[model samples]
Every structure is written in C-alpha cells, then in structure tokens.
Target chain A: MNVLEIQGLTKKFGNFVAVDNMTLNVKEGEIFGFLGSNGAGKSTTINMISSLLQPSAGEIRILGKDSRKHSRHAKTNLGIVPQDLAIYDDMTAYENVAFFAGLYGLRGKLLKERTEEALEFVGLGDRAKSRPSTFSGGMKRRLNIACAIAHKPSLIIMDEPTVGIDPQSRNYILESVKKLNESGCTVIYTSHYMEEVEEICSRVAIVDHGKIIADGTKEQLKAIITDVKDLSIELKPGSAYSLQSIGKIPGVRAVNEKEGRLSIQSDAAVDNLNRILKSLMDGGAEVKALQEEEPNLETVFLTLTGRSLRDQ
Target chain B: MNVIQIAFKEMLLSFRNRRTLFFMLAFPLVLMLVLGTALANAFSTTAAMDTVRVLVQDQSSGAAQQGFAGFRAEMEKSGFAFTDFKPGMDGAAEVEKNNYDDYAVVTNSGIKLYGSDRNAVASNMTQGMLSAYADRYNAAAAIGAADPAKAATAFQPAPSGGYVKELSLDLDRMPGSMDYYAVALTVMIALWGAMSAANLVNSEIRQGTAARLVAAPVRKGEIFAGKVLGNLAVNMLCVLVVITFSKVVYHAYWGDNLPLVLLVLLSVVVLSTSLGLALSYLLKSSASGGLISLAVQLASFFGGAYFPLGVVEKNSLLGIAASLSPIRWANMALNNMIYLGDSTQVIQTIGLNAGLAALLLAASAYMMSKREGL
Candidate 1:
C-alpha cells in the first residue's frame, strides 16, 4: 500500500502559483526524499499533504484516505516534523513530546511510556527534564523529532529536520530516520543538503519552480547525466588559459574558469582529460593540481537546471 | 479530550513563562494594593473633615419653635451645619443647586430628611444626628415630667417638638476606596485574560508550534477551544488569587453573596477569553499583545474600571460608549451586589456578558477556520 499519494497538487497565493501540478507517491516503508531550492514549493507541498494548508487544487491521500475529507483519520496515521524548531521552548523535552503525543490520543501508562521511548530513541533520555531553552541547537533538533514520532505514526514527513545542527546530531537524526523506516514507517524527507537525501532516501523527487522537474532513485538521477564528468584543474595564479580551445576539445561538454581554476565538463573525462590539460599547457597555464569529479545529485541538478541548487 | 490536552499544555507553558505570570498575577495585585490604599486614605481623610449641611424648615408654632434652635445647636456639634429654610421654599431645588447637603422639614408630625441620591452619605449622617437629638430631648422630657424640680434643672425642650420619622432616601452604605478599587481592579485585570488568550494564540502562530498543532489529529476548532480554555483557566485562577489576596490583605469587601460574586467573575472570564480570541484573529501575532494591551486600557477607561461610572456618564458621547463596555456592566453589577446586596442587575449583566462572549467566540471560530496558515 502506498503511504502517501499526491496527485496534481497545486497551490496559488492570489495569481502566483506556489506549487504547480505536482504528482507523487511514497510506497510503504521507503525513505522518500523531497529536494528543492528555497521557495521551490517544498514546504508548501508538505503543508498541503500534512493538511496544514488548503490546496488550491489537488487530492492528497494518506494511507489511502483522502486527506481533505478524512483529515483526522489521515492525520492519525501521519506525523510531520516541521523544518523550523517547532518544539515549545518553555516546556521540558519530555513534556513537549508528551503534549504532542497526547494530542494523538495516547494516555496514562501508554503516553508516559511512548514519551520516554521517543526521547530515548533520539538519545535525549538524560536531557528529558531540561527545557528546550536550556538545550543546545542539536539537542533541540532531536527533541523536535521526538515530538513528532512519539505517537508512532506510520508515515512521518520530516522537512529539513537536520538543518543547522552539529555533525553528530545530524548523523544521529539520519540514523533515526533509517531506524524509523526499518520499523515499518514510511518517511518523506525534505532538505537542502543533497548528500543527506542521497545517503538515506531510496527514491527522490526534485521540485523546482513549484513543479517536479526530476524524480527517480539516486543512481537513476545521476544516470540522466551519466556521460558528463566534471574536471577541475588548479593552475598557478595569473596563468593564461584559453576557454575557446577547451570548448573545442572533443568530448568536452562545457568549459568555465574562475580564480585560477579551470572547470571542464566532458562526456568522457578519461578520453578528454589529457587533451584538455595539453591545451591548457599550450595556453601558458602552469598546472598546480588536477582532479576528476563524479556526477552526483548536485551535478544532475546543475545539468537539468543549468544553475547551482544552492544559488536559488 | 483533545481540548483538555491542549488546554493543559498551554497552561503549563503559561505558568512556566515568568513574564506572563508577573503580568497576569503580580502586576494587578501590586497596582490594587498601591492604588486602593492611596485612594482609601484620601477618602477617609476627606470624610473626617466633611460636614453635612442641613436646611431646617421650622413649622411649629409659638414657644414650641424653640425646639428647632436646640436641634440646630446639637447638629452643629456633630459635624453638621444648619440653614433656616422658610415655609413654601423649594428645598429640593436648593439641594439641586448645591446650596445644602440636604433639607429637613420640621412639622408637627415628624422630622423628614430629603436629599438627592448622590448625597446619600450626608443625608444618612444628618438623619442619624437628628434621631439622636430627638431621643435625648425625649429622655430629658420624661425625667422632668416625673420630677418637677429635676425637670426644671435637667429637662430640655424636645428637639423640633417632633419625632424623627424617616430619611426619604436609600441608606445603602458607601463602599470605601479600597472596596471600590478591589472590585474595579479585579474586573479590569480579569479582562486582561483576553490579552493572555490572544498572546497564547499569537505565540503559537509566531513560534511555528501552531503548525504542528494544526497537523495533529485534532480539528482547528478543537485547537481554538483548547487555547481559549487554557487562557480562561489561567486568567480565572489569577483573578481568584487577586480577589482572595485583596480581601485578606486590604480587608476589601467582595460582596455578601459568595456564589453570585463568583458567578459574575466567571462571566467576566468568559467575556475576556472570547475578546482575546477575537483580537488574535484581527491582528498580527507580533502586534496582538500590544493591541490587546491597548484594548484593555481603552475598555478600562470607558468602562469606569479606574473611577466611578458617573465620571464617564457626565459626557454624552462617553456615556453612550461606556454602555458598550462589558467591563462597565460587570463592575456595576459587582458594586451593586457588594454595597447594596442587589441582584437585580447582576443577572442582566451576566447575561449580557455571556451573550457577548458567545458572539465573540463565534466570530473568532469563523475567523480561525478561515485562516489557511498558522
């Protein structure tokens, strides 16, 4: 069964469309990644699916139940960890989780047990009594996750849960996401960090301009530009280089230069690297270092949109 | 169940916030103590030196009129000044013109005291003095009649040669400044519960926790209900504490009807919570606190929360505006219950407040539902 199914989802603020004709599905127990630049309608789509927003046009089905018509039933099976630190600053970590968990109808022994379990799962057992105001940013992030999952929802949507945290906490969050997925919870994760998505998400969708520009597994997305490899060469300062000559090189797809570094994109890096380097030397370039780069999600995003994902 | 959970959590958050606790609890109590004590001292000092002027209209014939002279001398000794009012004079008109505090008509039947409602204190004092003087004269007359020689030495002509009939005015005791302000401040600060409710709603929205709340299995209306109930509980608790503290420390009278006073205050809480909910929807989250504060001040000003309603009623526009303030009705109802033990207006005021609360809650619920985002 699909955990979430969003079909032709659209949201408009006045005449401006925020999410346009978006369609997607998440299978049960898979870590699905939602990738987008800032204001790319990622949060908007998440809000619509979480039922926090009324879509201008769309049908969001959570666990095969229409989210709009049966929102309570749909919500009971879903949990949302917002991108922002949504935990109550005045409340203790335990209280924050328990309060949110109680809203899901857990009570008495079950409520206490689950609240503690969630805190412990996030490795915040020792700090459960401390208020979020006294917590470090990373501890607060973990508490944020605990509040969402305390109810043990089948499907948890995490919107950049690891944004602005230490490496240890980020890794812990990533591991927790994996553990949650393993325990039969389907996950929908959104983040600006492409590597986190690539690391955990089994399937991914890239949203841009309020539309899904690309969707596939990590390998499949990378395969869209499988022929392309990025070549970076460090040359001595003020060394002359010829862009026109590099652009004319066989198998070279694109060429650009900045700050004494020559970046060359080629369909076959091994075939064209020697020739590219030879041309650079012929142009009076003194090579300081040379390296070949493999295509990742960032490269695929750059290839598909012709711009850096972070720039937007 | 969801409403209770929401309310409980919100209450915990509110209690944990020291600033909210201070504003909702400590600020009002301190203000009540300082203002109530200061005003009470001022009123008591004034009352000590204040004299009630009575115009005596003597109607007894011949030597019997000597009683008026004795009565005037006795009243003058008791912080009362007497004026001679001739027959057929409009004593009521004179009182209206502020010529005398009250007027006494000394006829053969009895002594009648007349005063406007505003001169209730002076009128009662005058009546009491005249009654004591009559009693003294009657006692002396009885002694003289029993023994002729003793009567010659001890007997005095009866004051005004008449019995003291009745004071033709309501003799309800005036509330001391402390009593007046304890109720007034309670009513005014209780209205701040509306601000507390508004602040709670705004904080949830501003902090993004409201989004999580919205995403929960609870309905939007449940969330609204929870927030309002939470605010109401906290506000009512603060009010109860203030009321008890004032009564204990300042010896403030909260009315003889315990159940009724509580009922009236409960209604105030309802009105305040609904008002807060309405304001939250009407203003931005960041601006709601300031706007709510301004609203409470404006309501207190127009509603006679700081002074007598008469002060505002003197102005035509202000009188009409004051009539719209729930605070005005609540405070008046409380005063009536406390000073006069009158329940006639209490029910009406409670009904008006409850009705207003219902309307405001309805409007708030509609607006909350219409709001698409947190």
Candidate 2:
C-alpha cells in the first residue's frame, strides 16, 4: 500500500499560489525525490505532508490515517531532516539525538541505544559528546540527520538536507538516505542539486510554478525530452534562422541561437544531426564548435521552466 | 522530549550561560548592596531639614510641669518619633551641630510643630502627625484622671533629664544605606523585563532556534510553555540566592520567617518573568525585550524598592499601584515583623503580600497562555 498520499493539494497566500492542485503518492520503501528550484512550493508541499502547516485545500493520508484529524499520530512514524540544521547547538550531539528520540517517546535503554546507533550511522559516534560548535560544518550536518532518524521511523522526509555542507558530508548524507530507504523506510527528499536527485531519487518529480510539470522514473522524465538531446553540425552563418524550409525534418522540434551558435532542439539528435548538417551546409551556416552535448537534468529543468535551477 | 523535560534542558543551558548567570546573580548582588546601603544611609541621616519634631519646653512649675511626661508618652505611643529638649536650649545651633532631631516638637499652648522652614514635605507630614496625636491624647486626657492636677500639670509638664531617643532595631540588621542598597539593587527587574526580548522569544528567533523547533515535532504551545517555565526558574534562582544571602550573612530581617519571604520573592520573580516572556514573544526586536526588561526593573524602582512608598503620595497610579509592588509587600511584611518586634503582626502583612503575589502570578500565567500577538 502507498505509505503517503496527497490529493488536490492547494496552498494560497493572498492571491499568490504556493502550491496549486498538487497530487502525489509514495509507495512503501520507495525513495521519492521532491524536486524544484527555490520557491517552487517544494517546502510548502512537504510542510503540509509533514503536518507542520495546515493545508488551505487538500487531503493528505498518512499510513491510512487522515492527516487533518491525526497529525500527532501521523507524525509518530515519520522522521524529518529539516532544511536547516535543527540540532541544538548547546547540546552534545548524543544529547541532541537523545532529546529528539524522547520526542518520539523513545525511553530508557532504548533511547540510549538508538542515540548511539544514530551517531554510529552518521560516522560521528566518537564525537557524540562534542557540541555542534566544536564540529565542522559537515559534522554538524551529519549530526542533524542523526538526531532526526534516531527513533528509526518507518518513513523519513528530508528537506534540502545537504544544501551548504561540504562534499564529504553531502555524500555521506546521500548514502545514509539510500541506506535508510534500503532498510524498508519510505523517503521523500528535496534538493536544488539535480545531481543529488539523479543519484539517489528512485522516482523524481520536476515541479515548476507550483505545479508538478513532470513526475516519473529517471528514465521516464528523461524521455520527456525525447527530442534531440545532442547535435553536431557545420555551416556558415544564417543557416537555420527561418525553419519554414527545414521544419519538415522528420523529428526536428524548435531552434534557438545560443551565444552566437546555432542550437537545435529535436527528437533523435543523431538523425536530426544528419538532417541539420546536410541542410545547414546546403544553406551555408558556420558551426565552429561542433561538439554534441548529451542533454542532462539541467537542460530538462531549463526546458520545463525556461530558467536554470540555481538562478537567484 | 516531554515538555517538562524540554523545559529542564532549557534551564540547564540557561544556568550555564555566563551572561544569564551574571544577569541573574551578580547584577542583583551589586544592585542590592549599593541600593540597600544608600537607603540605609538616607534613613540614618539626622537632618532636621524636614521632619516634625515636637520639642516640649515643660515650664508648669513643680509637679504641674510634670504633665509633659505623660503627654510625651501619649504622643510617642501615637507614632510620633520625638526628641526632648531643655527650656533654654539652642535648637538651631543643635541642628547645625547635626544633632538633636530631624524635626522639633515643642509644646506650648496647644502644641508647636517646627522643622527647617525650607523642607515643605517634612513640615506637612509633621503637622499631620502632631494633629492626629493631639486629637488622640486630648480625648484621652478628657476621659478621666485620678488627679486632675497631675493630669493637667504633672502629666503635661516634666523635667528634661536629657531625654534622648532610643534606637530599636537589631544591630545586625542595621545595614548601612549601602547594605539595603546591595539588597535592593539585586531586585533589578531589568533582567526580568528584558526576558521578553533577550532570554525567551527574541533570543530564540535571533538564533533561528524557533524556526528549528517549529519544523520539529514540537508544537508551538509546547515551545512557549517550555521557554516560560525555564526562564522562570532562573529568575527565582536569582531571587533565592540573594534573599538567602541577605538573611544568612547580613541578617537584614527578612520577616524572620523564611517561607514568608521566599513566597513573596518567588511571587515577584514569577510575575516579572512571565511579563517579560510574554512581551518577548509579542515584540519584534530583540532590543525591545531588553527594553521591556529595563522597564520591569524601573517599575520596581518606582515601586519603592529603594525607599518607602508610604512617603510618596498614594494618589498617582504608579504610587497607588506601588502598594501592589512586590518589593513593597516584601518590605512591609519585613517591617511589620521587625518594628512590631514580633511575628504576630506579620500574619496580616504576609497574608496580604501572598495574596497579591497569587493574583499577579495568575494574571501573568493567563496572559502568557493567551498572548499570541507576534
């Protein structure tokens, strides 16, 4: 059975919509990637699912329980690694883990053992007693994850958990998320890093303008951009400006000028490459750097949103 | 963790905070010492600049003049702090000598009340006091007397065997103005008031802790309760340490009853802490909390923590409200116990103070629970 279900979720602020008619579901043990650039309502959507904020208009079911009526019980089986470092700076890492463990109602020997297990999981068992101030930025980030997951909840939600950490800590966190999912815990992760999402997210959702424009397996989303992901051509200038003549090329889509270079978007980049090269040379357009670049998630994001993910 | 557990953790962190410790302990200590000593000195001053002293020049001749003795007793019994002077004494010279009395009470005809003409407030108090005493005494004299001559003469006129006043107080508790100054200064409500901005809500926001808590499983209500309860413990700790020190080391006569004084101080501390915490969550600036804490301290200052509010007109809101000052109640309870030279009179004082404290505390708790302006 699906462990989490959100239907027709809509969040409005004044007339501006933060999340609009969004819908999603996560099967048990699946690593779900909640992907979006900043302000794409990713956090807002997760906040609703996590029961931190009330939904303006939506229905959420957690473990078959109505989120509206049973938020506390819904929260019991879920672990959240918030976007910010939520661990208490004044407390020792172990104590921080213990405090959160107690929040899940974990007690006595179980609490202690779980704290130690979490610390060891994050590879910071030796530094359990050290305060966050004493840890490097990466260590603090790891400890944050440790604190959140100490209770071993069946479902874990991480909100941009690795935004500004060092590469090692980021990798460690990514690995931990993967391990937690492998251990039969459902995971929902949010991040601006496409590579991180591509690396660990089993199924990803590409959101834009508060709507899930694309949601599928990595291969499926990639297929959304089935047109030419790469192309190489040689021609003189003024070769492909007016596509009326060449618009009939079997799988060709649209074309744009990129930094004084003729770039083409088309299905079957190789087949379209032959058509573009043959037509462009016939029409006379210069193509100095003719390296075919394989389309990645960044290109996909730009195609869907008309802007880069990291743009301010 | 549970809310109480979270609160305890907050307390542990607060206890170790160097600035918090200083604000809670050191600042009050220095303030109490300076204020207690200064006030003690102010009360010890023998300046006649303005106190109603009734100097009796009893010239009734033989036993007829002895009437001054009984009259003096009656006036003193009616709460007139008096001084005796000889018939031909130089009152002004004696005042210049920085001796004799703060005011002069010389009885001739009906009565004569005098003070250095410059001090108007003292003159008014003196006149009021002497008038009341005369009313009470004249009525008593009219009631009956075995010897009308003795009552009229012997009782009204008496010799001045250099009748000087006696100091009735425990020498140990005689803290110089500096002593009470230290104690009073410790009663600083700045920390308590600033609690809103500095210790409770503002600081948490400043550090991004509040957002962190919100994202966690903790509810907003739990966070609110935890912060208020945690900070209150720290405030009470400061009050307890200072009060305990004052009693053990200086014997400043804190009602000679630990539980009563403790209850009063605890009430004030909780009241101040809650007011501060509620305001902290209400205001925007961290500095606003600090500013409000200073307001709390200043309110106590106005509450007569440094001096008797009774000497102040009980008409102004602050003055009248000062009757409700936790400091005043604490002082009054202690004074009644000390001046009455017994604990029997303290029951009413303690009861009154305790009741006021309860009311303030309940108001604070309700305000804290309902306040969500921010």
Candidate 3:
C-alpha cells in the first residue's frame, strides 16, 4: 500500500507559482528522495503534504485518507522534521521531545517510554536533561529529529535535515534515515546533496521550476544519460588547439574548452575516443592527460535540466 | 489535554528565559519600590504643611462673638495661625497684606472662608476644619436645649488635644501617599502583562516554532488558547507577587474587600492579556514588543500611575484622555474600594474591563483566522 500520494498539487503565491501540477507516490518502507534546486517548490510541496500549508489546487492522501477532510487521521501517522531548527532552545532536550510527543496523544508510562526511546534513538539519551542552546550543532539537529519522531509515526518527512553540519553528523543522519526505513517507516527525504540522495534513496524525483523533471531509481535515471559521456583532455600550458574538426567527430555531442582543458561530450565515448584524440593531436595540441567521466545523478540532472543542481 | 500540554510547555519555556523572566517579575518589583517610596515622600511633604495662616474678622456681636471665639480656639489647635482683624480693618485686605493663605468672616448666619485657588489643598483643609467645628457647636446647642445635664457632660468645648464633638455626617478618608502609589503601580505593572503576552506570541512565530506546532495534530484554536492561558498564568503570577510584596514590604493597604480587589485585578489581567493578543495579530513580530511597551507606558502616564490625576485633569484635553484610560478606571476603582469601602465603581470598572477584554479577544481570534499561511 502507498503510504503517501499527492495528485495534481499546485501552490501559488500571488502571481508566482511555487508548485505546479506536482504529483507523486511513496510506497510503504521506501526511502523516497525528493530533490530540488533552491526555491524549486520542494519545501512548498512538503508543507502542503504535512498540512502546514493549504494547497491551492488538488488533493493529498496520507495512508489512504484524504488529508484535507481527515487531517487528524493523516497527521496522526505523519511526522515532519522541518528544514529549520524548530527545537526550543530554552527547553531541555527531554522536555522538548516529551512536549511534542504529548501533543501526539501519548501519556503515562507510554509517553515516558516513547520519550526515552526517542532520545536513545537519536543518541542523545545521556544529554536528555541539557538544553538545546548548550548543545553542538549536530546534537541540536539530532534533537530536532527526535522531537518529530518521538510519537513513532508511520511516515516521517525530513526536509534537508543535513543541510549545514559536520561530515560526521551528516553521515550519522544518513545512517539514521536508512535505519528508519528498515524499521518499516516510509521516509520522504529532501536534500540539496545529490550524493546523499543517491546513497540512501531507493527511488528519487527531481523537481525543478516547480515540476518534477526526472523520477526513477538511481540506475534508471543514470541509464537515461548513459548514452552520453564526458571526455576531459588537459593540454600543456599555452598549447594551441582548435575544435573546428573536433565538433565534426561522429557521436560527439558537444565540445567546450576552458584554459588548457578541453571537454568533449559524445553519445559513444568508447567508440569515439580514439578519433577525437587523433584529431586533437593533429590540431597541434600537446595532451597532458585524458579521462572519461562515468554517468551519475549529478550528470543526469545536468543532462535533463541543462544546468548544475548545485548552481541553482 | 492538548491545550494544557501546550500551555505547560509555553510556561516552561518562559520561565527558562532569564531575560524575559527578569522583565516580568523583577522589573515591576523594583519599579514599585522606587516609585512608591518617591511618590510617598512627595505626598507626605504636601500633607505635612506647618500651618495655614488665616485673618479672622468678627462681623457679629453678642452671641456670635462667643461662637467666633470657640471656632478660633479649635482652628488654632488644628495648626492654623489666626490673626484677629480690628474693627476698622478689612479682613480680605489684611489677608492680602500679610500674604495669608485665607481669611474668614464670622457673622450671625455662618462663617465664610476666602482663599486663593493656588493652594487648594490647604484651603480645603481649612474649610473642612471650620465646618467640623460649626457642626459640633450646633449639635452641642441642640443637646443643651433638649437636656441640660447631658449637654454639660457630653458637649463641653473640646479639650485642647481632643477632637470636637461628633457630627452627624461621616467624612470620607483619603488614601495616603503610599496607598495611592501602591494601587497605581499595581495597575500599571499589571498592564505590562499585555506586552508579555505579545512577546510570548510573537517569539514563537519569529523563531519558526509556531509552524512546527501548526503542523502537529492540534487545532489552531487550541494553539492560540494554550498560548493565551500560558501568558495569563505567568502575568498573573507576576502581578500577585508584586501586590503581595508591596503589601508586606511597603505596608500598602489594598483595602478591606480582599475578594473584590482580587476579582477586579483578575479582570485587569484578562484585559491586558487580550490587548497583547490583539497587538500580536496586528503588528509584526519584531515590532510588537516595542509597540506594546510604548502603549503600556502611554496608558500608565495618562492613567495616573506616576502622579495624581489632578495634575492632568485641569486641562480639558488631558482630562478627557485620562478618563478614557483603562488604568485610570482601575486606579480609581481600587482607590475607592480601599479608602472609601465603595464597590459601585469597582463593579462598573470590572464590567468595562471584562467587556473590552472580550472584544479584544474576539478581534484577535478573527485576525488570527484571517491570517494566511500562519
């Protein structure tokens, strides 16, 4: 069964459309990666799905319940870790989690048990009594996640949970996301880091200009751009070179030169590498190094959107 | 249950914020101490006038002279300097020549007091003393007519250090300086709760925590109600602490009607909280705190929190402004209850305050509902 489904979703702010005709589905227990450039409507869509924002058009179904008509039912099973640090700095970590947990209807021994378990889950059990203001950045991020998941919701939506943090904390969060999914919790993970998405997400969707441009498994997405390969050839400093004939190479898609480096894109790198090199050598270019690039998620995004994801 | 939890959490957060806690609790206490002492000194200085000089001219002979002599002795005992005018001297002319505060003309009918308007306090005190003396004498004469033995024992000229014979009408006692200021500062500081409420509401929104609560299963109404309840609890605690501290430390009288005083104070808390809530909805989070502070300061100034309303009431515009202040009504009602044992004004002010609070809350709720993407 699908844990979350959004169809024909749209959000508009004044005359500007933040999310346009967005639609997707997340199967239970799958780590669904939601990728987008900055201001690409990813947060807007997540906000709508989590009931923090009202969609201008269309519907959202959470665990087979219409979100608008049955918000409580939908919200009861959903947890959202917002992009911003939403934990209270004045409250102890335990108090913060317990407060949010209580809001989800937990009480008595169960409430205490869940609160402790959530703190333990985030590796903050020993520091539960410490306020977030005294915590390190990584610890605060962990506490933020603890507050959202203390109720043990069926689906957890994390928006850029690792945007700005140390490498260790980022890795810990990535591992935690994997563990959450393994424990039968469907996760919607949004991040600007394409590598993080590629590592943990079982399936991914790339949203740009408020529309999903690509959706599939990592390998499936890579396969779409697999026909193209980037060949980088570095020439000696001040070596003269021309691409008048190189552009005519069979299977070569595009050519760009910067400084003493020439980059060649071709449909068949292996088939066209030999000829392209010979043409470059014949053009009086002293080649210092030659390398062929393999296809990855970043390349896939670049191929589909004609721009680097990081640039946006 | 959710509202309680939310309120509890908000209260916890507020307590943990040391700066806000200091402003809420300690600031008012310190202001009460400083202002209460200063205003008390000013009032006592005014009340402690050495003597009021009066020029007395006897315009009647025979029995009236005896009456004037009796009245003159009583005035002398009560800290009045009397200068008897000779037959040809004009009493009013003598008062002006000697720069006396006032003069009196004793006739067969009654005594007439004349004084400048600048020294109204001294003038009023002199008038009251003369009236009390005349009333006592008239009562004594009536008793002498009815029973000679009783009049001789009960209605002799009052001894030098004793009060005059009792009059039929009771006099209203004015509140002392400390008592007046205690009530004024209490009302002023209680209204600061409105700013506290505004800060509490705006902080959550500014910090982005409000959006997190919104995403929870709780309804928006529950969230607003929880915040208001939490703010009210904290503010009421601060106000009670200030009130109790003033009563115990400064020996300020809150009046005999303890229950009624508490009820009216609670109404003030509600009004303040509602004002804060309404301001939170009307202004930006960053701007609301300063605006609330400014509003409370202005209200206190016009409401007679710092000085007597008489200082401003002489000006028509200021008088109207003072009358419109909630703090003015609260101060007057509390003063009446404490000094006069009157509850009529107390009940009216409470009703007005409660009604205004309800209106503000309604407006706040409507504004909250109308807000988009909150």
TM-scores for the candidates: 0.80, 0.71, 0.79
**Residue A79 CA error for candidate 2 (Å)?**
1.3
Clashing pairs in 3: none
Work out how many backbone clashes candidate 1 has: 1
- Report the lDDT tens digits of candidate 1 across residue range A187-293: 99998888898899999898888999999899889888866898888999988878999899888766767788877777753487778888988989899998988
Q: Who wins the TM-score comparison? A: 1
Worst 10 residues of 2 chain B by lDDT: B189-198
Q: Give per-residue CA lDDT, model 3, range A1-312, as digits (tens).
A: 999998999999999999999889989989999888888899899989888789999889999989999999998899989888888888889999999889899999999999999999889999999999899888888988999888999999999899789999999899888888888899999887888988999999988889998898988888888668988899998776678688898887667787878877777545988788788778777889999877778778777876667667
Estimate, for each residue in B63-142, the C-alpha lDDT of model 2 and write its tens digit.
32344465556557544556667767876666445453344444434665445555456556666755755664565466
lDDT of each residue in B159-180, candidate 1, tens digit only:
4736676664643567778887
| Better model by lDDT: candidate 1 vs candidate 2 | 1
Q: Rank the candidate models, highest TM-score first.
A: 1, 3, 2
Q: Name the DockQ score for candidate 1.
A: 0.63
**After best superposition, candidate 3 residue B256: deviation in angstroms?**
1.2
lDDT string for model 3 (B44-101, tens) is: 5234686898877778775457766866786687688888777777767655665777
- Alpha carbon lDDT of each predicted model: 0.84, 0.67, 0.83
Provide the lowest-lDDT 10-residue window in model 1 chain B. B152-161
Fraction of native Cα contacts reproduced by each candidate: 0.83, 0.20, 0.61
Clashes (N, CA, C under 3 Å) per candidate: 1, 63, 0
Q: In DockQ, how does model 3 score against the reference complex?
A: 0.53
